[model samples]
Target chain A: MAFRYPDGRKFEPKRNEMTKKSVNKDARFSNRGMTLEEDINETNEYYLAHQVAVIHKKPTPLQIVNVHYPSRSAAVVTEAYFQKPSTTDYNGVYKGRHIDFEAKETKNKLSFPFKNFHDHQVEHMKRVLDQGGIAFAILRFSYTDEVFLLEATHLIRFYEERDHTRKSMKKKDIEHFGYLIPLGFHPRIDYLKIVDKLITGS
Target chain B: MAFRYPDGRKFEPKRNEMTKKSVNKDARFSNRGMTLEEDINETNEYYLAHQVAVIHKKPTPLQIVNVHYPSRSAAVVTEAYFQKPSTTDYNGVYKGRHIDFEAKETKNKLSFPFKNFHDHQVEHMKRVLDQGGIAFAILRFSYTDEVFLLEATHLIRFYEERDHTRKSMKKKDIEHFGYLIPLGFHPRIDYLKIVDKLITGS
Candidate 1:
């Protein structure tokens, strides 16, 4: 199928067609073009390889319908549909603590919109927090290339207050409540350093 | 696409055509005929609803090759292949501990085969244990209706010693090293009670 952007624009899958100049531009901009999810995945891989943490991104849920098995080949899934995820995107163990979080990126410079997340995700995060797990969101302001580790409690409060307040969270509110995550080269996004501070207060 | 069992038997999709007597047999046996994976899933669901724990089975990974999108509804995956899982089947947070485990059942009354697991899964479990997460395997003896939570460390030892020792672990060794998980109605398998004992030793 033809891949489409959120705005309904057809997304060409030929990423290799991009010019070297654009690639250099991306490098110079500290990977401003890369998605937050990609950066987090790279970070998780680095962590796993280094024996620093055991974080992993959960596989995308798919409801398989029909599968065909050939005589001497791998089975092929012929019909399937994507299912809505019931839990957070990333989870693992860090210093014996259960770490759970979702990573999200938004182009909006003034505020982070609530539409980027679902109600079930928020509820799942709340349950994680209640169970003594460290639950949060890695929020990335794509336009500015700034990332923050916002605790689940803060997000939950804003989500519950949506009935009376604006649907989006202001940048000032995020700056006040969230901890800034320093970007790096090896791990790309060092959100765990922020987690360290959250755990040790050091 | 047609479904088939691992033994090369073509699976007819008409599950509803089963006789009532067979259904009665299934019900009377307390779902003993069901796969261990299915029982664990039901147990996980029960745990989630009762706020006992928040474990979940990760969806089977699929490598999508082709998809079809109609103008109005969700996109349907037209061609895909199941990818080998890199980690264990189940994981979640329980009482502030990161719980990670794989569940396997063997009809053999003598031993559980080591070939049922992959190398990457063992490596993943090792990482979990290194990070202080609770890592184990839920071994089910289908014939005896006995389930045991064998710690990952024990499994790793047996796995690494395969060159010198037997490729499979005897049931006697498992009975000595593993903690038996009691079967129940609400949670179905009370593995956490074993976990609590493992934690507190009380």
Candidate 2:
């Protein structure tokens, strides 16, 4: 059977398109244009290869309605639809603690809207936190090209306290509460550097 | 879109059919008849609700070949095929350590054939072990009604030591190397109790 991550294969041609300019250029110049999801996935692969962590992006949840067996060779999925994920986008083992996080990239200039996340994801994060797992969010501002790691506790607080006036997390607050992800070449966004700090409670 | 897990829904009717007989029955009788996958899913749900752990079964990996956007309601999957999983069946955090494992049930009383596991899953478990995460397999002997927790190291040894003669893991060898899971009413398989022991190194 064929194997492919939903968006993973879709990004390949685009990545290949960047080959000419990205090949010889420095790390930041080559990678700054990639999506946050791709960057994190590449980073996770690097960590896995290096034995640094076992983090993985969970597959997109789908509901298969009908399957047609054309022959013994293959069973084809004829009818299915996307299902909202019951948990965050990414999770895995990190330094003996359950590492869980949702990655979101926003085009808004001043703040990130609370609408970016679903209710179940917020609840899942809370449960993970209560279970003593490390929970957080990797947020990226598309226009400014800034990525920050915001701990779930702070995100939870903002979410719980949200009102019509306080609908989203402000950029200044994100800057104050979240750690900026150091972007580099090979692994791209090194969020684990921040995770190491989180592990040590520093 | 429906949020049903592949087998999760498939088993519901069978479980409903068992409600009358299983409702008043003892835990062992009630759960012993259930599939290992269902039991583990129910156990994980219990753990999550009680804040004991945040484990989850990874969804079956499928390669989507085509999608049909019929109106704005839902995008229907027109073509897809099941793919080999790149990791174990289940993983999560337990008492501050990463827990990763595969669960299998076999009708064979003599042994569990090594062919039950895919190459990628074994490699994934090894990587998890090297990264200091907990890795193991939960094997249930169906005919004899026995369950054992075999650590990845032992399983790895059995796998690597295999020749044409040693095609499978003998039940006797498994009983010697693996720990019997203490099953219970609410959780069905209390594998974490075994995990607690592993963490303490006692």
Candidate 3:
């Protein structure tokens, strides 16, 4: 005996049951526990649709091992592993300026850990700044729900100073050097307005 | 009895034999039949390593359906499908300017088909241009081994005129409107020289 819909379509009970449970769990998490990444992605989508800026978060790189190619359909990746990203998470054009940045979320109320960024990523940001592009990091305090856009110069300075003092940057230092991004209804995290001020020096 | 290497490692005969055959076949093709995409990727790698410029081809977007998470190792993608890219293949910062472009290779000797580009990609390129960022296309003739850097403005004009004329842009038209990129050893496709000309009008 198998389960069937009202329209008489056959349904696999086990798979559907598992899927329903997963969906409910995801809904619960998304409502009150949406990640910083998810919020930034939604903001980027709004920016694109409204023709505000052309920024995008690059897709996570994967090293695929085996792919199953079925007839008359798309190939299915059977085995794959996530590769460490070689560059920053986000980059694009904003007002003809090359904008590049990484987004990091910290649960600590007092400080953000320096270990959140890799050595290569810090070096990459240095190169972007050297080439005259605008580079920064969006640091999100998960507990406070506060987001700040910290310029690459300030980030690099703090990164280099990690060997001498604290292993993390204090919230007060971030407040001193970074611009706070206001959360809005449509765009969510409006970081571009901060960029505009940085460019104009106003 | 199982086959074993001199170093006491067991060798899987069937898998190794198949892998060796495939490697040989790929080597044969890569010698004289590598793709335009490969060349551009090699050039980008060279740019990054030498600290000349930072450019990267975005990874192919995939829609993951199922994942198997093992306790000891990284999560493996059990099922996934390729998704149509919403943006161009390549984009980066070059000399303080946002650079965005698509590379297309055609075997057709007479004309490059407009069908190589999707409507969304063309629209995206137009947006890049409107924001004063540098946008262009790298058109490569596979048979002739010729590559040209055509600016986005010219490409948009020809794309709009496609309904009134032939479905493809003629080689003569490409020659007239685009700058030919001379192939070199170190940097491979030296398209940046043409970008310099575009910027300074030299």
Highest-scoring model, DockQ? 1
* Residue B196 miss distance in model 2 (angstroms): 1.5
**Segments in model 2 whose C-alpha atoms lie over 4 Å from true places:** A1-33, B1-33
lDDT of 3 by residue, A14-62 (tens): 2221223344456434424756776788788887888888888877665
Report fnat in order of the candidates: 0.51, 0.41, 0.46
Q: For chain B alone, what TM-score does every candidate structure achieve against the true structure?
A: 0.84, 0.84, 0.83
lDDT of 1 by residue, B1-202 (tens): 3344444433332222222333445544666566677678878888788887888887775666776776444566687666667899799999888999999888899899887777899999999999989999999999899999999999999888776467799899999999989987766788888889877862
Q: Provide TM-scores for the models.
A: 0.86, 0.84, 0.84
Scoring model 2 with DockQ, what do you get?
0.30
- Candidate 2 residue-wise lDDT at B153: 95
lDDT string for model 2 (A57-158, tens) is 776666666667555455666876665667898888866677989998889999999977878899989888877788999999999888999999999999
**What ranking emerges by TM-score with the best candidate at the front?**
1, 2, 3
DockQ of 3: 0.27
Q: What is the lDDT of residue B196 in candidate 2?
A: 85
lDDT of 1 at A58: 84
Q: For residue B172, what is the lDDT in candidate 2?
A: 92
Question: Which pairs clash inside model 2?
Answer: none
Give me candidate 1's TM-score against the actual structure.
Answer: 0.86
